[model samples]
Target: MPTLLETYIENRFRVQPNHANNNETLHGGTLMKWLDEVGAMSAMRFAGETCVTARVNELDFKRPIGIGDTAVVESYVYDAGRTSVHVALRAWREEPRTGEREETTASSFTFVAVDSEGKPTPVPELEVGGAEGERLRDRALSRDR
Candidate 1:
């Protein structure tokens, strides 16, 4: 098994016109698409298999991501259950040229492990070592309550 950090990579994508609403800001649908995709990737790392969204606790679009801004979505495995994984997802917007960044949206999503045939599959026990791991695990667990 690989260290959690080894399996983690921040995903960055631009907020294209097609992803925007008539007002030119990123649509809610677009934000969720990115969140779900990144969250699934995080869960797959811990599950070591394909995963599907089981629930999305909350999706807060605190700020708007406008056109010409790059949307940076960061996701990482934070906690796990017998057959489920929790992921912390954050979206940020940065000016394409100057690199000014600000958080635009945030969400936490849960995913369940699935076998090749798409049935529920058991996942490995989470081994949260070190201070950072402990912190992330605590945060993820807190979200359940």
Candidate 2:
């Protein structure tokens, strides 16, 4: 079994001109893509199989990340079904020099584990036993409200 913490994944992307809109802020599509990638990685880590995105819950952008800022994306598996893994994802904008960071986005995703034949496959039960695991799971669940 995989613990919730064991499925956590964090990645950083430097926002450049190509990733920005005319306003020079990170594009929504770009951010969504990053979120999906990170979410899938977390799901795969928990399932130990290839995971394909099944659904993306509501995503809202709270702030804009300007070009030259670092966009940090984090994701972890919070719950799982027989073949579906639920992941919570969040993104923050950070000033590289100052190390100041503020959350910019949040969303949840569902991924289905797949076999080599691309059919849905069962996954092991998630272990959310320890204090840290429970805390993380609670945090993600709270975001639902």
Candidate 3:
């Protein structure tokens, strides 16, 4: 059985000219696209098959990442259904030199495992047996203070 922690993913994107808006900050659409890509990867790891995004439960853009900064996207599985996985994903804006960061986006996405024919398929039960897994799941389910 795979644990939620094992499905975690973290990736960073440079806020370059191609990824930024005229204001020199990361564009909202660009951030959303990156979020979906990373979220799907996390869900697929848990499902062990190709996964298709079914829904984005929540997405809040709390801040902005300036040009030359790094956008760190993190994701992990928090729960699972018969054919779907629930994932928590967030983006943080970091100063590449100083390593400072602040939350820029937060989201919950649902992905369904699919067969070659693109039909939903059963996925293995999600396990949260370890302390890390429990902690992560709890944090995802709780409201930030």
Which predicted model would earn the best TM-score? 2
Tens-digit lDDT track of model 2 for 19-125: 99999999999999999999999999999999999998769899999999999999999999999999999999999999899999989999999999999999999
How well is each residue in 4-95 modelled by candidate 3, as lDDT tens digits?
98899999999898888888899999998998999999988888899998998888989889989999999999988999998999999999
Give the C-alpha lDDT of model 2. Answer: 0.95
Candidate 2 residue runs with Cα over 4 Å from true position: none
In model 2, which residue pairs have backbone atoms overlapping below 3 Å?
none
Instruction: Report how far off residue 6 is in candidate 3 (Å).
Output: 0.5
Candidate 3 Cα outliers beyond 4 Å, as residue runs: 143-145
Candidate that would win on lDDT:
2
TM-score for predicted model 1 compared with the true structure: 0.89
Per-residue lDDT, model 3, residue 24, is 84
Model 3 TM-score is 0.95
The lowest-lDDT stretch of 10 consecutive residues in candidate 2 is 136-145
